[model samples]
Target: MSAKYNHWHKSRHSDPNGDCVEVAKGSGGTIGVRDSKAGTPDIVLELSRTEWAHLLTRLRNV
Candidate 1:
């Protein structure tokens, strides 16, 4: 996820009702997560590359 990640990516599991989280890659190896249902001016949860990987692993195990 780089320049192509400039746009938010919602999961395939996202429902029509818009209940999902979106992920995007930011500069300096930072990752951004935000609510898909959050219209505009939403708060983004920022994570480092390592943190992002850990989160994915934890989620996958869940």
Candidate 2:
């Protein structure tokens, strides 16, 4: 199944009204993220598999 089904949502750190970034797990195993306010060609950020793992680990302890 496409890993996009497992979304990588952005944190609600400061934004209270849900105006935050966008994140999703791509089928290619990398983590896909973008600015929710971006338009046209979205500024997508792709994280490596290893990078994604480390990020999750760090966030888990935060």
What are the TM-scores, per candidate, against the unseen true structure? 0.77, 0.55
Expressed as tens digits, the lDDT of each residue in 1-62 for candidate 2 is 32442555776663776567767778787777676667632467788789878987998999
Model 2: residues >4 Å from true position, as ranges? 1-8, 55-62
lDDT of candidate 1 over 1-62, digit per residue (tens): 23234678888878888789888888667888888667753577888899999999999999
The per-candidate count of clashes, in order, stands at 0, 0
- Minimal lDDT window, size 10, model 1: 1-10
Measured by lDDT, the strongest candidate is 1
